[model samples]
Structures are given as C-alpha cells and as structure tokens.
Target: MTNLLHAMLGKGLGGLEQVFLDYQPILEAWAAKRGGRCVGVVRNGGKVAAAQAGRTPPLIPMPAFTDWDPITLGAARAVVRANRPAIILSHGQRPARVFAKAAPAGVIQAVCVHKPSFDVTPGTHYLCVGQHLANLALERGAAADHVHVVQNAVRPPPVQAQPFAREDGPVKIVAAGRLHAKKGFDVLIRAVGKLRAWDVDVTCEIAGEGAERADLEALIKTLDLDPCVKLVGWTDDIAGFLATGDLFAFPSHQEGFPLTLLEAMAVGLPVVATEIDGPVEILDEGVTGRLVPDDDPDRLAEALGELISDRDTAQRLGAAARELVLTEYGPDELARRLEAALDGMLVNSKA
Candidate 1:
C-alpha cells in the first residue's frame, strides 16, 4: 500500500487551507479503500489543526519556513523517514520548497499550486487548482506533462424544503473570504452602495475576518451603508450562511479556484463574481452566473443590479450553477482524478 503525505504551509483558514481541510479526509478515505494511506503535515501551531477538528488519517505538525535549516530539516526528514510516504503532496510554495529537500529518494514530490505566484521547481509535478493556474505554471517553465489542472469541488448541500431567501423581503447578498484588498471587498461595498442609492432593497453581508476589516468598515461608514452593509466576521458555518443569502457576490481581484465560490454554487446561490481567472473559468457569463470586471465598482454595481432586479433570472442562474458543480466538480469525481494523478506520479517515480 502506498503511503501519501499531504503537506502545507499552514497559516490561516483561507481558500488554500480550506482545500486542504476539505480534501484531506476524502483523499484519506480513497487511499484507505485502495489499501493505501494518506496523512497530513502542516506547520506547527497554525489554525489548520483547529479546522481539522480531529479528523484523520492523522496530521503531523512541523516547523514552517525552515527551508534548509539543518535541525528543522532533520526533524522534517525524520518525519518523512518514519512515515515512509511514497508520495509527498505539498500545498503551497514554502511547503514545496521544504519538502523537496526533506523527502528521501524514491518519494515523488508534487506541489499543488493554489495561487498565481508559485515556485515551479524542476522535476516536481504540479496540481494547478484551475486551468488558468495551469497555464501560468506552464509559462513559468514547469514541464507541461508534470502540471495537472484539478478543479476544486464541493458536496451539494442538503435540499431545502423552501428557498432560504425571501422573494418579497430585501434581497440578502453574501460575499466571503479574507478581508484583504485582494478580495476586493471595497469594490463590493461600493457596488452595494450604488444599489442602495438606486433604492434597491438589498443587504450585503461580508463574512470572514482579516487585516482589511477596519478599512472595509470605514468604507461602509463613509458610503452611508451602515445598515445596508455589515461586515460579519469569520464563520465556520459557511454553507448555512450561503443558504440564507439570495445571491453570492465574489468581487475578488485574484483567486486560485476559490472553494467558497464552489460552495455558494453548490447551495444554488446565483453568483456575481469578478471576471478574473478563477471566476471566469467557473461562471459562464450569464448562464451559471454574472461576471463583472475586476476592481470595477461600476460594472460590479451593474451586475448586482441586474440580479437583484430580476428574481426569476437569479433563480434560473443559481439552479444552473448548482447543476454545473454537481455534475462536473463533485467531491467524488475530484477525488478520483486526484487518485489517478497520485498513481501517475508513483509510476513516474519508478521510471
């Protein structure tokens, strides 16, 4: 049975971390069914442990950023020796660098690229989270055959007896992610302001906390969107939150296959997202959801207005989005693809 180690530079509960938490158990179960094993390795004292909540194969916490430090490297190498993993799948750049040096000979090393900026080390296979990221990896000198595009997946939410959002009440719009500039929460807030000015009865709830919380709060106040826009901090119940919203607005300036967007789609929320790499790949312009230009509040406002004004269109798009995810990006399908990739890597290592 092949033992696999999934390693990551654990920091916060962002999309990357979420991907690790969501897929770790599924991958572990898949491995177990095949008479193999999957284990997780993350930086010591990071939030990843809390997110895992006692799930397994098991999680091994090690020092982060210890790229060639003899002592830490020795410790990591010892873990590798003890586990004897045939495949080491590193989540981000830092973890990739650390594992590349620590993994013993014969162990296949693969890096999962979850963002635009990544290190394309020679001889390491890359699992790009989106097609756009895969293209970027190829441009950065990664071997074309070594890079694989793996779309993020989510389980469809339990069917609700009744639709969550009220068609008669003020439309509830939800957007989630780290409160950072890259997320473009400011652009979303401005869009909400414009909608409010046009007398559209809509309330926007920005979930998840980060460094940009104060600035976002200040912008909300400046725009006189005190009651219309609320910055709700980090939420563990993302599915429940999305269930209550009429629409999902993702105005991110950058992304690498955002799990929340998939989650939103799974719950049948019509999405209005920025026309960036990840969103462009996910949303089919007006089919699954509406796409707006990145960082453009006016265009964002226009898109939001279109969905808010047309409930029928919103419901149709949301349903289409849900079907798209269920059919193409389900957890089981993604897990199978991952298993195939791991198998391919093992064979390549032998070659």
Candidate 2:
C-alpha cells in the first residue's frame, strides 16, 4: 500500500486546522480504497493532536516545527526517512514551508492551501480549498497542472438542521466566525441598525471570538443597538446555536469557501451573505440565499429586511440552500474530489 502523511504541525484551531482534522480520516479512508494509507503529523499534545485523538491510521506527534531551525528540519527529515511515504500532504504555512525541503527523493509533496499566503514550492501540487484559491495558486507561480480544486466542506451535523420556525418575537439573525475586520461584522452591525428603519424587528447574535470583539461592542453601542445586537463569543456547538436562529447572515469581506456558511446552509437557515468569492459561488440570488454587495451596510440591511418580512420566500431559500450544501459540498463529495486530486498527483509524480 502507498504510504501518505497528512501534516499540519500548527497550534490552535481555525478553519484550516478544523478542515485538516475533519478531512484526515476521510482522506485515510479514501487512500485505503486505492491500496494506500494516510497518517497525520501534528504538534505533540496540541489542539490538533487532541482533536484527532483515537482515530484510525494513528498520528505522528512531534515538537512544534520551525522551518529554518536545524533541529526541527532534522526531525522532519528523519520522519520522512523513517516513514518513506509516497505522498506528503502538508496543511497551511508551517508544514508547507518545511515539507518542501524535508520530503526526499521519491515522495510526492502536496500542500493543502486554505488561504492565499499558503504557497507550495515549484514541483509541489496544491489542493486548494476553493476555485479562486486554485486560480491564485496558478497566478503565484505554481504549475498549471499542479493545482487542484478540492474545495472546503463540512461534515454532516449529528442532527439535521431544524426547520425555520418563529412563533413570536423578532426575527433572529445569527452569524458565526472570527470577529475580525475581514469578516465585516461591523458592517453587519451597521445593517442591524438600519433594519430598524425598515420596520423589521430583529435580534442579531454574532458568534466567535477574535481581536475585533471590543471594537464590535463599541460599534453596537454607537448604533444604539444595545437591545438587539450582541456579539456572543465563540462556541463549539455551532449547529445547536444556529438551530435557534431564524436567519443566517455572513458579511465577510473575503472567504475561500467558508465551511461555516455551508454549515449554516446544511442546517436549513435562510441566509443573507455578502457577494464575496465563496458566497457568490454557492449562493444563487433569490434561490439558495440572498447576496448583497460586499462591505456595504445599506445593501446588507436591505436584503436582511426583505427576507425578514417575507416568511415564505425565506423558507424556500433555506430549504434550497440546505440541499445545495449537502449535495455539492458535503463530506462524501469532498472525499471523492480529494481522492481524485491525490490520484492525479501520484500519476504525475510517476511521469
């Protein structure tokens, strides 16, 4: 069987880390189908290691990786020598930086690009998490054939997304992601302030913790949205948290296939998102979900207000969105595409 290593020797949890952990076992299973096996490489006793605990194919936990450090370099080289994997799939920046050097003679090195700066070396292949990412990889000196579009995806929630239900009270709008300026949560808060003028009563809860938390709080006060807009910090239970809300709102300034957006869709919440790359690709206007111009609070507010007032249209869009995510971006489809990409890399390496 061909040996493969899925390396992400980084700290903390985010979209990149979460996708690696969730996709590891699926990648392993996919490899197994073709007479191969995939193993994880993570930081010893770190968040990634803990999350990937007790899964099949095991893992190789080493001290944190430093690209230029001789000790770290030697350790990486030693792992490559000992494992002698046919393919080394490194996730994000750190592993990408080192694996290009660590992977010796025969191993086919591939990097899973979660965002733009996560580049691979000339000969290495890239499994970009989004189509635009693949395009960017090509633009930034990667070989045309070396880039593959595997796309980002989310595993099916334990329970299906509950149906849209609002017996009383205002329409509940929910958003989840890092509270960064890039997420455009401030614009969402501004939009919440404008919803008042449309005579649409709504309560907005933005989940996740980031550096912008304090700034967002201040903005809420400035908008006089103290009663309706609240930045509810990060939570692990995104599915459960989303189930309680009436609508999902994503005002991200940029995204390379957001998994949380897919998660929100999978759970059947009518969504209104900014016209960013990922959202634009997946959401069809007035179909799956509503889309407003990015970084524009007035447009965001208008779209949110329109959906809130029309319950029938909101429910239709929610159901369609749920179907789109599950059918096109679910774990099963992700695995099939990932396997195909890896298979292509293996063939090219032989050639």
Candidate 3:
C-alpha cells in the first residue's frame, strides 16, 4: 500500500490540464485497491481545480508564481512529509520545479513531460509522451535509464454508430484545440479559402477558445470566409461536435500526443491532419486518414478535397480509424502501462 501524488499547476484546462483531471479518478482508484489514496496539488482557483469540484482524489490548492517562496516551499514540504507518498508525479514545468524543492529523501520524483524542456531535476524520472520528447530529455541531461516513453491514450466514445449515407451538401470540416498559432487555425482557414477557390464546397468550424481568437477571427474575415468558417469556442461536448463533422482536420504545426486526433478518430471521423509526429503516429498513410504537409494550406486543402470527393473511401477510412482507437488506445491499456512504469520507477528508486 502506497500513497501517490499527481501535482499539476497548469493555468487553464488545455490538453495538459485535461489529462491531469482525467487521470485523477483512475489514479485514485488505483491507490484505493492498495489501501492508499491519490492526492493532487493544483493551482488555486484554476480551471482544472474548479472542474474537479465534487470529485474524488481531493485537491490541495497551491499559490501561483511562488516556486521559491519560503512559505510556499515549506508548505509543499509539509504536505510531502504528511502524505509520505511513495511517488510524486508532477506534470508541467512549474509543478516539476516546485515539487523538486519540496520532495524529501527516499521519494520517487517523476515528471510526465509531453513537450521539450531544459529543466532536469536531479533524481527525477521522465515519462515522456513520445520518442521525440524522450530524445529531448536525453539531450537536456536526463539519465538514459530513468527516461521512459509512455504514449497518451484515449477512451472510446460512449457509443459508435457507422455514419449514415450523406446527402449532397458542403462537407463539414471540424477542427478543435486552443485557438493558438501553433494549432494553425489560420492555416486551416486559408485551406478552406483554397478549397473554395478550387470549387470544393466546404465549411469549417474550429472549437476551443484562447488568446488567438481575435487574430483567427480577423483572418477569417480578411479571407472573406464569412458564414463558411467559424470559431465555435471551447466545447464540453467534443464527441457530439465531432459527430456533426463529416471530416476532422488537425493543422497543428507541432504536437506531442495530441488528444484531438485520437478523439476525432475514435468517433469514426475521417481525418485530414498535418504530417507532424503526432498525426504520423496516430494516422496511417492512405489507410485510416490523410496526412498533409505541416502548415501548407494547399496540401491540407488537397487532402481534404480527396476525402470530400470520395465519400465511400472516406467512410472506410473512418471505420478503420475507429477500429484502431478501440484496439490500441483504450483506457485499460493506459492504466496497465502506467502500472508497469510506476512499478519500474519504484524498483529503480529503491535499488
């Protein structure tokens, strides 16, 4: 029986925060079986914490931007001493730095890093989300044996039904994620304009909200994509939105285990995504989905056009994509993988 901690101080409920929140219930149940419990240290009044209200694996709110404050450090140290968790799993840059200072001797300190960072806390094991990220950790001076690659996982949608035969209409393309530049919504907008110029009837909706919303909206208007492309804002009913989409588009310039692609594919939505690492890993060339060059509007539009033209082929690909998610990326598989990694980390820490 051992206590476990998952500390996340991420500011908003982006992919990082979503993973943190989703894992709590699973981790809590994991510890419960061993007569222990899971605990979280999150930013005070943050969206993740607010969303975790009335949920299991209770939270301890921590002050923001006080990574080195004596009181903050002492408080975190006190929590560690009181909980005596066998493992401290910190997510995000700030949590890693803050907890490294508070972690006592004999505790296994591990960081689940999805993106590259130069920070390497001594004695901390890295659970990177991809080989690329694992390589980055090695370059950043992490111990070779201590770094482990654990890919992200997604739960299948609540229900799966084969898409119905479509009547002729504009192909509804749906893309989701924060409206940041890295998400490449501007590129996606341009792709839509290209599609229109090529006489491929299509409409697009981008879900999620961010600081880049204004810029994206301005670009949409400038391209005169009125009533054709839209920013749908952040959505809780992601599956429902995906259901309405005839095609899913992911145009990110970069990614590290993007949940958007998995979520879209899980619902049998034929995808057209940039040829980034995340999409490459999730999609099969000419099989489950279409892959286009990163940030290239023409290529993105071309791929979308192909799928839009061949409805039968697109449906077949969506079916294959759905099967891929069901067979390989289930939550059970993730839990098993995590158990093994945590066990290995514990053994190595004690050895």
Candidate 4:
C-alpha cells in the first residue's frame, strides 16, 4: 500500500487553506480504503486547528521557515523518512520547495498550485487548480507531462424550497475574500459607487479581513458609500452570509480557481466577476454569469446593473450556474480525478 504525506504552510483561512481542509477527508478515506495511511504536515498548527475545528487525519505541526533553513529542512526530512511515503503532495510554494528537497529517492513529489506563483522546485509534478495556471507552470519551465489540470471542486449548497427572490428593497450584493489589492475590493467599491450614481438602490457587503482593510475602508469613505457599502470582516459562515444576498461580485486581479467564486455559484447566486483567468474559466459569457473587463469599474457596474434590473435574467443565470457546478465540479468527481492523478504520478515514478 502506498503511504501519502500532504504538506502545506498556511497561516490563515485563504483558498489554499480551505482546499487543504476540504481535501483532507477525501484523501483520508481513499487511503483508508486502500489500506494506506495519510498524514498532514502544516505550519502554524494553531491556525489549521482553528480552521479545521478538530478534523481527522491528524496534522503534524512543523516549525515555520521563511527560506531554506537547515534545521527546518532536516526536521522535515526526518518526518519524510519516518513516514516512508510513496508520494508527498505539497501545497503552496514554500511547502513544495521544502518537501521537494526533503523527499527521499523514489518518492513522488507533486505540488498543487493554488495561485499565480510558479516558484516550484525542479522535478516536482504540478497539480494546478485551473488550466491557465497549468499553462503558466509549463511556461515557467515545468515539464508538460508533469503538469496536471485538476480544477477545484465544491459541495452543492443545500437546496432551497424556492429560488432566492429579490426583495423590493435594495439589491443585495455580497463578495468575500481577503481584503487585499489582489482581491480588488477597491474596484468593487468603485463599481458600487457607479451603480449608486445611476440611482440604483444597491447595498454591497464585503466579507473577510486582511492588510488592505484600512485602505479599503478609507476608499469607501472617500467615495461616500458609507450608507450603501460595508466591509463585513472575516465571516465563518460564508454560505449563510451568501444566502442573504441576491447577487455576487468578484473583482479580483489575480487568482488560480477561487473557491469563493465556486461557493457563490453553488449557492445559486448570479455572479459578475472580472474577466480574469480564473473567473473566465468557470463563468460562461452571458450564460452562467457576466464577465467584464478586469479593473473596469464602469463595465462591472454595467454588468451588475443588468443583473439587478432584470430579475428573470438573474434567476436564470444563478440556476444555470448552480447546475453547472453540481454536474461538473462535485466533490466526488473531483476526488476521483485527484486520485487518478496521484496514481498516475506513482506509476510514472516507478517507470
């Protein structure tokens, strides 16, 4: 039986962290059924503990290292030797770099890329969350045969008796992510300002906290959108928060298959996202949702305005998006795909 070790250096509840948590159960079950063992090695054990809330496949906390430190690398090498894993699945650049160095001979090293950074060590197989990311990895010196496109997946939200009905009051729009420049919350605020200028009764609420909170708040104030737009920080129940909204907006400048966008679509919310690599791959133009030019607040506002004014279009798009996610990106389907990729890597390592 093949022993597998998963390593991630995470400090907060970002998309990569969420993927680590979500994939744990599936990977654990797969290992168990095959009479194998799965172990997780993470940095900042307390942060993962809070995010996981006492989950299975017990995590081993390793000392955090900014760069390649001998002590840290030696300790990681000890863990890999002890486990004697056939495969080491790494998440993020730091973990991949460390694990690639620590992994013993004949152990397959696979790195799951969740963002734009392609600083993976040489000879590491790439498991990308989207096709664009995989392409980027190949462009950045990764072998084509080593790159695998494994898109992120989400469990379908519980079915509501009826679709969400837009109330007669303000159109409620919700966006969630780390409050940073990459997320483009400032552009979203500007888009809301444009909507308000057109006298559209809309309320925009953004969730999650980050380094850009102060700047985003200041931007909100400068736009005088205090009454209509709010920065609701660090929500635990994203689905519940999304349930209360009628539409979702994502104005990110960069991403590698954003899980929040998947969550929004799963919850049956029509989306208006920037035409970036991640969102464009998931959203069908004029079908599932609207995709406007990145960094263009006016175009974003126009798309949002169309969805807000036309209730029928919003409902249609939301429902279509939900169905698409359910059929194509279900957890079980994605898990099988991941398992297949791991199996292929193991076979290739032997070859």
Candidate 5:
C-alpha cells in the first residue's frame, strides 16, 4: 500500500498553484499517518531553497520550460527512481506526459485534466475535475475506462451573512477568477454596460489579478462604468469578500471545475454564471443558480438583475444553494472519494 502523490507546479502563479498548495498540507499529514509520503514539485522561485530550509521533506524543482529543452523525461525518471512510489498522480497536462514516460511499468498513473490542453498521453488514466472535462478527455483520446470525474472541493469558511442589508438597493454583482482572457471578464463588462440602459442600479466588482487587469479596467472606464465597476485584485479570504456582494457571476470561457461557484454557494449567494460546462453541471438553472448563455452579457446581466430585484426569491435560492453544498460538496466526503478512487486503481492494477 506504499504510495505517493506527486503534485507538480508549472508556473509560479495562477489558480493551479493555489489549488495544489491547498492540498499539500492535507496530503502530507494523511500520508505520514499511513506510512507513505506526498511531495510537491515547485519549479520556480525559492521553492527548492525553502523546502530545504525547513524540516519538511524534500521536493523537486527544475528550470523553467525553454525552447530548446522541454520538460525533461530524465527529471521525471529520476523522481520515480528516488521515491519508488507504487502509484503516481500527476496534476495538469504537462506533468501527466512527463509522468507517463517516467513511471515504471505496472505503476498506476493518474493524470488530472484541468482544462483543454494538448497533454494527453497514451496508456494513461485520467481524473477530471468536472463531467465536461471527463467527456473532453475521452473525446480527446483518453480511454473511457481510464477516466473518472472528481470535482474539486474547498473548505468553506464559517457561514457569514451578507454585510450589507439584503434590502433592495444598489445590486452588487461580482465575477471572480484570474483576470485572464479566458475568463471573459470583458464580456462581463459589456453585459454590465448593456444592463445600464435599462436603468438598473448595479455595480460590478471583478476580484482577481492577471494580465487582463489593465484591459478590463480600461474597458470599464470606456464604457462609462468607472463609477459602477471596480477591479479588486486577489484576496486571501474569498468567502468573506463574496459575502459583501449580492450575486456571484462567472463568465469563464473554459474551466476544469471552478471552486468559485461552490464557494459562493456555500456562503449563500445566488449565482448568475455563464451556462458553460462547469457552471451548467453544478447549477440547475432555476435552483441553486441561474445559467445563461456563455459570453452573452445580455443574459448574464438579465439574470443578475432578476436575482437582485427579488429579495424573497433570492434568499430562498441562496438558502437552497447553501444546503446543496453542505449535502453534496463537503470537503471530508470529497477527500474520501479521492482516497477510494486511488485505492481502486491500486487494487485493480494488482489484479
């Protein structure tokens, strides 16, 4: 039953880092109890230096991907040589490719498909974050029997009621994600602009940081929404931040499975997200959240406005959302599911 979960970091920043970082502590403690080990490989910054500084176990870090040298197969082979882990679980596309090559014959390899990427390798099993991603992986050549859907989970902060009174006032709308083009924040800004024509008193707060910050800010000003829109950068605490808003909006063009929607639901906020794959799978249109056409700010805005204008309905929906998350997305339950999946893979491989 000896095992190790190898989490590799590609870029020094972004949602992937945030996600893998959150799980490191949990996996480390859990592995120690089971007499196994889990290691994180951060490829940038003071990762290697920092790991050595503390009494914590060592993790591998390599040079950044370059034109001449892609992710080296040798490095992956060396890691497996050192750990001698019975199973390898690689997160993200590139890691999967490297692990597929590096893993010894008979070692189980589970690759996580976070988004659309050209990283699929032959004879590799997949752990998709959402149903859409599971389907995408199979369609893109991953064996159907080798793939499983395992949704991401977050430890919801203590339930906090909206700070501002829930009365009918300025409709505070929120869209959260890294300020990347894939997030479709510009589309959200445009939708907000269109909503203004209807004299809807709305203010949108885009919370996150990325390359698209300047562009989105400029769009807000150009659309005469400088007063109505604000781009708040990344925050350590999301539930508390979202508690100040009335509705949560996500217009991402693509996703593995966004924890943002679930976080919002846990905090009892009614959602108005794009009817994209991830959101559609989590939200039932008239139930936990409203699903609108992707990139269509018109529908997004209309849905946001509808939720804001009706307080009783909004409260009812919010209550339902919170209940749903508690019942279905608990962190402990999710961890158990992951452990079971890994155990199944281990047992089936031996058979």
Candidate 6:
C-alpha cells in the first residue's frame, strides 16, 4: 500500500490547500478501500496545528521545513524512511525540487506542476494539472514521457438549481479564490467598475481571504465600487453563496487546473474567465463561458455585460457548462485514472 502526502510549497493558505482539502475525503476514502493511507502534510505545521488544536482528527501533522532547510529536508527524509512510501507526490515547484533532490533513491518522485518554474529536474516525473501545464513543462525541457496531464477533481456539491431572474440593477457575480495578486482580482474589480459605467447593473462578491484583501478593498473604494461590489470573505458554504449569483468571473493571470472553476462549472454557473493557461483547457470559450484577454478590463467587462444583457443565452451557457462537468470531470473517473497512474508507476519501479 502507498502513503500519500499532501505537501505544501509555502506556509500560507492558497489554492493547493483548497484543492487537496476539498478532495481530501474522496482521496482518503478511496485509499482506505484500497488499503492505502492518505494524509495532509504542511511545512512548519501552521495550518495543521490550527486544525489539530481545533480537534480535527483526520489531518495528520508531519515535520516539514518551510524554507527547504536542512532540518526540514532531514525530517522529510526521516518520513521516507519510516513510512517506506512507494512514491512521494509533492505539490508546487519548490517541494517538487526539494523531493527530487532529497527524497530517497527510487521513491518514484511525482511533482504536481501548476505554474511556471525553472527548478524542476529531468528525473522527477511531473503530474501536470492540465494540458496547458503539460505543454509548458515540455517547453521548459521536461521529458515528454515524464509528464502527465491530470485534470483536478472535486466532489460536486449537491445543488438544486433555483431559477434566477435578472435583477433591475447589477447582475450578481461571484469571484471565489484566495485574494492574491495572481488571482487578478484587481483586473476584475476594474472590469466591474467599467460595467457600471456602461450602466450595466452588476454586483460581484469576491470570496476567500489573503494578504491582498486590503489592497483589493482599497481599489474598490478608489473606484467607488462599495455600492456595486462586495468582498465577501472565506466561507465553507461556497456553493450556497454561489447559488445566489448569476455568474462566476475568474481573472487569474495563470493557473493549473483550478478546482474552483471546476466547482463553479459543476454548479451550472456561467463563467467569464481570462484567456490563461488553465481556463483555456476547461472552458469552451464563447460556449460554456467567455474568455477575455489576460489583463484587459474593458474586454472582460464587455464579455460580462453581453452575458448580463442576454439572460436566455447566459442560462444556456451555464447549462452547457454543467453538462461538461458531468461528462469530463466526474469524481469516480478521476479516482480511476489516479489509481491507474499510481499502479503503473509502482509496477515500473519494480521492473
């Protein structure tokens, strides 16, 4: 049996945590049924310590070094010795580089690559989050055979779609993710402000928390968006909050198979996202959602305004988005693919 470690690249909260945390139950259940144990691993134990202090029994605490120090490396090596894991699946570029250098020999190191990085080695097999990631890896000199595109999977919320009538004022849009610079919340706020100028009634609820919250709020205030935009903080009940919105807008500068986008699509919400690596792979532009240039607020606003004005068209797009999830992104199917990948890697290791 294999033991899985959800390693983090940084000490702070981010998408890697959200992606794995959201799917932790499904992965753990699958592993248990297969006689394997899956657990979360955080460096310095900040998140895990908080979780444990709250009496969250399921989250396991492992010694992790935040800055790739010798102590952290030694601790991770000790874990490899004690557990004798058939493979080490590490997320983010930093951990990927660390495990490649320090993990025990022949441990079948698998690095989950989601963004641009210059540190990866040829020996480490890359589990890319999407085709876009795979392409980027190959372009960066990673072995083609060593790269595998695995679309992220999340348990779809059991949603009962309620009919939403177009409001007289702004269209209710929800942008969910950690408030980071890369998330492009600044661009999104500007676009919303643009839409307001066009006299298109639109209100956006930006969810999740991070260091950028203050700056984002300041931008909203400067743009005079208090009446039209709301920065709703982190919530576990994202699905419930999304249910009240007419659309989802993610203007991230880059991503690797964003689970939030996948979740929104699963809930039958229309999206207006940037023409970035990850979104291009999942969203069928102009069909299920509209794709605007990376940082062009005007174009993004234009796309959103178009959908806002045409209720029937937006609903049709949203319905199609949900159908895409049912066909291409089922949880069970993802589990099967992961099982196959793990089995193949283990068998090849033996040979």
TM-score list, all predictions: 0.94, 0.94, 0.95, 0.95, 0.89, 0.88
* Candidate 3 backbone collisions, by pair: 208-233
* lDDT for 1 (candidate 4): 84
Q: What lDDT would candidate 4 get against the real structure?
A: 0.84
- How many clashes does the backbone of model 5 have? 0
lDDT of 2 by residue, 14-119 (tens): 8878888777887788667768777788887788788768756567887764688887787788888887788888887788777777887777888888776665
Task: State the lDDT of candidate 3 residue by residue for 1-351, as single tens digits.
Answer: 889988998778888887776667777877788788888888887987787776654688877677888867877887788888888898877777777888877778888887765478667898887778888888888888788877787888975534435577787899899878889989999999999999888899989999999998899899999889989888898888888888899999889888888899999989888888777877898899999998899899888888887888999999999999888877887777677777788779777
Residue 135, model 5: Cα distance from true site in angstroms: 1.8
> Model 2: which ten-residue window has the lowest total lDDT?
157-166
Candidate 1, residue 346: how far the Cα is off, in Å: 2.3
For residue 128, model 2's alpha carbon misses the true position, in angstroms, by 1.0
TM-score of 3: 0.95
For candidate 4, write residues 1-351 as lDDT tens digits: 878888888877678877887777777777777788888888855488655556564688887666489977987898898888888888887887788788867788888988886674567899999999998898899887788988899887764212346457788889999988889989999999999999999999999999999999899999999999998887778887887788899999998898899888888889899999998899998899999998999999999998887878888999998888889888987898788887778777777
Which RMSD values do the candidates have, in order? 2.0, 1.8, 1.7, 1.8, 2.8, 2.8
Model 5 misplacement above 4 A: 29-34, 46-59, 64-74, 163-169
RMSD of 4: 1.8
lDDT of 5 by residue, 193-262 (tens): 9878789888889889999999998998889999899998987678888888887888888877788888
lDDT of candidate model 2 versus the reference:
0.84
Off by over 4 Å in 4: 159-167
Q: How accurate is candidate 5 locally (lDDT)?
A: 0.74
**Clashing residue pairs in candidate 4 (N, C-alpha, C atoms within 3 angstroms):** none
Clashing pairs in 1: none
